[model samples]
Target: MFAIFLFVPARADAAFCKTGETVTLEGEIIIPPVIDGGEWFWPGKFAKRPCQVTTLRGKGTLPKECAVGKRMSLTGRVLDAGIVTLEVASIRCY
Candidate 1:
């Protein structure tokens, strides 16, 4: 029963990307806080842009609560290929 329930897909499924569509996203990441000049930056630089996310690994989609300075990993399709940015995902003040 649990397995069957898990199989069910959620209404808000992550967005799927076309072959050439591209999107850029930037957010602070708590997984590994970014450092600049030996300082912990709440809002990291452009981290991922034009990122290619395979079925196994890719940011499908993120929550709205995620802020520019808050650590996060955005998952959007790229309108164009070979374009990436390293921006902040989220923030960890603690």
Candidate 2:
């Protein structure tokens, strides 16, 4: 007899953000489950998890077209890599 087990891949918790580094992350915006929680960005195609953005400041406003679950790009400086907080300089929605 043979036994086999298959497992689904776990969601990634670590983001590629580094403090003080400027990066452009493209992903879908997700609303956090908790009340009053800030919106999150899942920074990849088919990403299984989301990263939080503590604050968004600079050139652009949250466009009406960029709603939750919509794909968008955020260009920013990472303020906190642990929590994936970004000082967003620009935003683009598709």
Which runs in model 1 stand beyond 4 Å of their true positions? 1-45, 49-64, 81-94
| lDDT tens digits, residue span 54-89, model 2 | 454344235676777777677778786445466667
Winning candidate number (TM-score): 2
Error of 1 at 88 (Å): 15
- The parts of candidate 2 lying over 4 Å away from their true place are 1-11, 32-60, 81-84
TM-score of 2: 0.52
The total number of steric clashes, by the backbone 3 Å criterion, in model 2 comes to 0
Cα lDDT tens digits, model 1, 1-94, are 3554346655332333444444444334445433445333222133433243332123223344544455444433333234322222332221
RMSD of each: 10.8, 6.6
